[model samples]
Target chain A: MTTVPVRPPLVRSSDRIVAGVCAGLAEHLGWPVRMVRIGMAVASLAGGAGLVFYGWLWIMVPTADESAKRNARRPASPIAPAVSIAPSASMPPKHAAAVDPPLWTGAYSPGYPPGAVSTPPGGSAPAAGPGGYTPAAGPVPSVPYDAGAPSQPQEPSAVPSTGAWFRVRNMRYGKEILLGAGLLLVAAILIARLLGVEVPLGTLIPAAAILGGAAIAWMQLDETRRAGLVDKTKADQAGGWARLAAGLALVVAGVLVMVSGSGSWEQTWLALLASVAVLGGVALVLLPWGLKFWRDLETERAGRVRETERAEIAAHLHDSVLQTLALIQRRAANEHDVVRLARAQERELRGWLFRDPARDAGQLSDRIKAAAAEVEDGLGNAVDVVSVGDTAMTDRHEALVQASREAMLNASRHGGGPVSVYLEVSDGGAEVFVKDRGSGFELHAVPEDRMGVRESIIGRMKRHGGTAEINSSPDGTEVRLKLPAAAEDNGEGKS
Target chain B: MSTPALDGTAGDRGRTVRVVIVDDHAIFRSGLKTDLDPRIEVVGEAGTVERAIEVIGRTRPEVVLLDVHLPGGLGGGGREVIAGSAALRGTTKFLALSVSDAAEDVVAVIRAGARGYVTKTISGAEITDAVYRVAGGDAVFSPRLAGFVLDAFGTAPADIADDELDKLSARELEVMRLIARGYSYKEVAKELFISIKTVETHVSAVLRKLQLSSRHELTKWAAERRLL
Candidate 1:
């Protein structure tokens, strides 16, 4: 779906360090401003690309509120300027803010809802964060199911995907082919005996000699070519199930021929068919499973390799970012807002560091922690999150995290005291309970404009293959969000 | 805002509790200095592990607020500070104040003789109470961190067979650690001063033993086990 014409986040006139670009980006994207600036600064390392990019973003991208006014008047000026930027200098700074002075050091992240799928190759990488580590988003092989198709028309981005597939399809197995041929020859000999052909048994001697010569020829192929003979799902293995059934039928026919035809006409024809069927059945049933086992081994090996990569990333994050953030927290001065930002940033960094790539959110406990921190950062309050049971990583984790965050926000706004979050994970699924001691409001009392309770909380759970159970009274309010084990297909959230 | 830095006989018990805050960050130290319970006196503070040892030695505070990561002398972390101040172990207590609740950090500090390890999230009152408890020779840890300690050093550790680690070479272990932390394959290669090709080989071997599907699953597995 084509979203509304994109506009730059507004510069927080009150919180600008240098034109509030970083602040705007951070606020707009729910990312740490410092990281955004750092990311911009890092992007600059590409031979002043960062500076030039930041400059264009400054002049072109309108502020958030102003964009609303502009959108009302007309559609955005057809998505970005044609010659978006000069190769170097000689760029005009148009449509000045009129209030704030032009500052060289700022860029705002585009405004997107929290947990939205980040459309990249545009936004400052720092602003695109769950674990805040997309800066390292190098090439990833596309999924096997869609390896043949890519949505983007121009770019040929399926090289690695095709490469993996090619390796699998091209593989061959010589030993199986040779064995099949040998089995067929044995069946042929049995059939010939039953047929009572004019040729004697000595005629088969030359056939054996020819088979040995073919085996010798097979040994001449190179090691790689020879190894190809071990293929699992090649042409030789196709009608295995059919062959099994036919072999049983043929065996019955051969025995019948031996019994009935012996007393009447020629029994050799019946014996030949029966013996051949038995051979086909036994080979089809046993050999295919061998191929299946081999294929499983290949996938398992690949899985192990991926696991190692993830573990390495986690370890590096532990030593580098996690530790560094801790030290910074202890050392940095208590600039109230800065300290709060640091705490929030620390939690986000942790989340980003440990997140599962499959889901925007990682473990259940992690989602709870992130939601709690986000709530605390947005609304100044203490959220104590207690997790119970081993957390399972599931695709629905991001949706669940989103719902929990909204519930926490609702609690902090209406609830009277500290928010207590309890996350319970079990075999069936996970349940997050956000409880606050504040005076509760009736569910029906919520106004139409407010989307927190209705859409964010309840709607999110339903789309995520789960449910949100909210209970409130004068005593307090508790939002128990339930998630099913087999989560539904994602990305169906409605406004 | 109204009270002096110290009030006469601030504690109900009529005695002042002395403290030394050791952390690399100046702001956190200053904040701690102001927010500390009135009865607790901030005698001295240092940022590096070496200075922390010296400050704690000179101040001989009853309780030392230690951060896990510092600047000097053998990585200058809290565990180092605790080990350096072994001479004052019986008289002085070390309460680790850190942002990390990672099992590794917690267990390392606690194993190195920290009286307690509380995360920075705790409020001043809770920290003060923890300090007092540690001063009285009691051990303390964050609820989550305590679990890490138990899992790492508790009775279950032996059954888990730390020896399974023997199967991995030191290099492989290093590779596993970097991958587990969520580093990109290329980044791991750069950090370890090895070729990306070598990293891939090592990764294959590590995954083979771990029996995991991919880096994503590996990250989750490491997190669940608290190895990360």
Candidate 2:
């Protein structure tokens, strides 16, 4: 005999008289509709059991149209029915024979598209045999029967390949399967009690406790797993925390049920204590794993930071040092050019390497150094600057730096030897001494026409309420600029 | 013009000073050797700390012009060489030369028993003079080194006792300031109305205090005021 199709889901049919309950049940069970109707009528007259059963079925079983709508809304995998069903249809006869007959005859058909039952032709005929029966006269069509509904093509077509009878079609249904099994167990127990069967509370309560606890834990775990598949938001995190709490509560309830269901009061108390100790031991065992996870996270973050810093250093070297080296290589024959390039690159690198990230640009020491560097670049004369202390930049300090720069320029221009600049900031005042080993020219002997030293240096310092002393001897020329502490405060107040 | 005086002084001694140059750059060492006054003789050369120690120990040069930063051996560079040659501390004096004016580096080598510290930019005549002075048992403080010493020791903390050995004497402070202002020892002596011998004595005393004092505060002061 040809393998029969699986039974359809227990949903109310569109063809209905008195809510279509009998018709839906007959179609789900693959029985004649008239038989189920007559049976329901007889049961109602006997004890009103039929009405209660009918009510439960009506509440639990959605109508064909409603289930079809839900199928449309489900975010099922977008694989076409032809791709999924083709493999199952081509299953080897031996593998198909291995499928369990009882499971194939069940009233739930999760793999078939819901549209199979919602179609008018299929809904009206309960004798169509499981709503999945296609005549075996020709090759089975790869396309679903209800191809008109584009959105429903893949909705419920989560059919595992017929060759593997035990393989689940979708992992997302694990929670649903767990929930259904729980409800079925509860129903079976209740029905047994109704039939006057003596069900032991001892066995039933602990069994129910374990099953219920396991269901809740599994559902929460499945939800957490699904949530991880997408980006986690703050709300998802809170939900995760709530799930953890619920799982913990269920575990505690399970423990309590086991303890209470045991032999004697003393045994119950002992079991409760043992469970608490077991939980503590479990926690102690897991503590190191948690700490290791936390340390790994920190190490990963540090590695990322180091990676970024290394990238930045590499980029900087490529941009500045490497480029200068290339230029120097090309100009190797020019001794002066190579020396100048190397010197400039060295200065740039030194500044970059030793830069104080905390220092601001407006500090007195920075400004003086910039000034000295500027003169050295312009005059090709080396100016060595040594700064002992620093103060906030003020108008007086600015004047001092300016005077110092001018003195440096004059010294480098006229001084026959290297120049040195010293800056000292003290509570009494600030002083900048610009000394060059140039043959000294008398202050008066300097023609009035030379305004650089007199006007730029002396004049600027005087305007800022500071003093400039030019000491000249046969040894060298030293220009000393001094800013009193009171003048600095005055400058700050004025500003 | 100052060359004549330096040459005359060395000529009066009638012997060239023995020297060893320790620098990583071969070009720099050779250039320095060529530019130095004929009154100084280059007895040996080395490029690394271990080799420097070996040469300094073998040659027993009167002076070692040691680069503050060198390759090989312990990463301590010049300080390691000085420490390694401890047996020859009296006979061989170390004058640190560097391209950087970083305060901590200068202070570290000085604390390691370097007699003087000078930047690489010092003229050949001046380097020759510094070598001679270091050989003569006098400390050679470049203007920058003088500035660093002044800044380190000049600001006396009120909490420190008055007679702390690390504290610079008034004369030593004066000498440091003058040197920091680019005054030669002769000029400083003339400016302070003291003899050149007195200036040298004060500088030597300061150097001694810097090397011998086991003061954490001095080191902390230098570290805190690093010139970066």
Candidate 3:
């Protein structure tokens, strides 16, 4: 058993009858493609086991080039650094298109040239630009400028003994294909013997001759040109459809073989038992790698997609909404009107950012600061937010945030110059104190139309099962809000 | 953004009341200029506290249209600018034109010794009259702003701290007023019939006794205490 790399194994990008699994195996093992396909066909004719095994392989394997493209797009890979000049593997712009543009491109196209060893381990390099040649000292110069090489002694340590290296590396991927083909032939023999199909032990020699001739006719062609000719035999059929056709043909042929024989139930049972034993053995060997390949593929792709989405949203918001709001505020009727408009826009923008999934559960102190910053910008008040609690904001993040925002705005409106915000985690929850040094307003004296104190502050707190306290004097007014954590609320409720 | 005229509209008094508008809002400044008395010549305009000082130094206007809140040289807004431009004292005076009518804003600018405090809501003619009154050496304010100043500073010195004020001699107090009013040293010398050196001595002594840095801070210090 080959010890796989930490990252997913490479899959072949071209040449396949579904999922590029056999093609990928051929690349990994360097066997003639003819042998693998023949082995597959013979196994399929024994029963439906081979077809089922092939379908499993198709889903599990990620073609090598697809993995290479992923490698290029991924910023960091543990195995990548150990393999070669790994930096270029992460250069998406340089290699992504050159490798293969689509996820399933490998299943349809021919795998790279017989010269495939020259291709980067992370396949997508445009060195396909130069017939995939592995120049002497090739890997060291992968990145043209050679930026990181001088700093570390990584390469020489990696190369094995010269004789061993060449035997393993220059084998050019045929080793596994032949080995797998031989195994299939042995399994086919076992099935025949089980079926009471007369075994021609002497015919094995003729079968070898036939296999060799077929290998010679098509096997030497590894580059796209010959692979293209081989692919034409696929005849406008996608890999999955072609596999469907092959499986049906093999099943029909097997039925004829069976009917021509004794047609006994014992023969059918024997064939079924033999097929399961062989196919299960093969699956035991290949499935782990296939699962690893799929895991690697999903992880890299999902993360990249999410990052792209966030960047796009940020750019659009900055260019459109923010600019338009600024222009409107400047053109408003008077300073007061401008201030009011600015305050409203500030509130909306803060709310949007706070509610964004990325930073919604961040430190409550940071959220409080964001609210203070908005009021400071919109009203030109000096706001300082201080946090002293060791606990996180807990379940009341949004409600406490809104209530705090209203309090900050009120301070800017009715309070004197510098406004201070303090967050303290005392008891089982958080207390937010917003203080301003100014004459305080009479709670009862506030008009019905004013909502900052009533709806935004008091009402918001009530909804969250929190309490808001307002104290005023000639010196200053302080609004203190106590909010219980979500866990604490549940704990109390259960009792 | 308009270029304020260097010469005032001709008045029966026969003097062009040269003025510089130092408000941040260009549109409001221009609109206010259009409504001013023809006798008031809008000499120049500046948009920040720093530029206002530089523009005032060069033009030496009789009255400047200063905003109560401004950005640029220092953070204290109008008070910082008034404090920074000490050399232009007797030659020019500053009157604040602001959008804020809050008592703190009114008292703050008044303490900075703005000859007056008026809201942007005042009609053009009213602003013009206020400017002339300031130019003629009378403290002016919109009625409500005046009330804030009187309540805060004008009514009684008894509630005020006398520590800084007591440091000034009678002559020093007079000189400090001239300095805070934006009178140049030469003008102060001429008005007091004293040598320029004597006037300098008095100004520095007043600064030292008040624990102030420059004539800029002196004006702020005096205006803040309502000594002028």
Instruction: Name the best candidate (by lDDT).
Output: 2
Candidate 1 per-residue lDDT over residues A196-303, each given as its tens digit: 855444534444544454434334334336555354465434444344445445445445544453344455565566767987899899898989998997898678
The numbered model that scores best in DockQ is: 2
Alpha-carbon TM-score of each model against the true structure: 0.38, 0.58, 0.28
For all the predictions, what are the DockQ values? 0.02, 0.28, 0.01
Please report, in order, the local distance difference test score of every candidate based on alpha carbons. Answer: 0.57, 0.72, 0.57
Q: Which stretches of model 1 miss by more than 4 angstroms?
A: A1-340, A348-403, A416-420, A437-495, B1-15, B87-90, B121-123, B136-228
Tens digit per residue, CA lDDT, model 3, A1-495? 111112124465477666676666655544557776777778889887768867866775566665677667756452433333222232322221222222212322243343332222432222222222333334543442333333322222221122223343434335555666688888998999998998766545444544454444343333334454243444434553544455444443354334435356777667667776986899899999989998997797678778878998888688657775777767776765655455455544544543435433467766787788778777876565545443555445678888999998898888865576666554567778787767888889999898889888887777767889997766567788888765444443221
Q: What share of the true interface contacts does candidate 2 keep?
A: 0.54
Worst 10 residues of 3 chain A by lDDT: A152-161
TM-score of 2: 0.58
Fnat score for model 1 = 0.00
What clash count goes with each model? Answer: 39, 0, 23
lDDT of model 2 at residue A78? Answer: 20
Which ten residues in a row are the worst by lDDT in model 2 chain A?
Answer: A121-130
- What is the overall TM-score of model 1 with all chains considered together? 0.38
Error of 3 at B55 (Å): 46
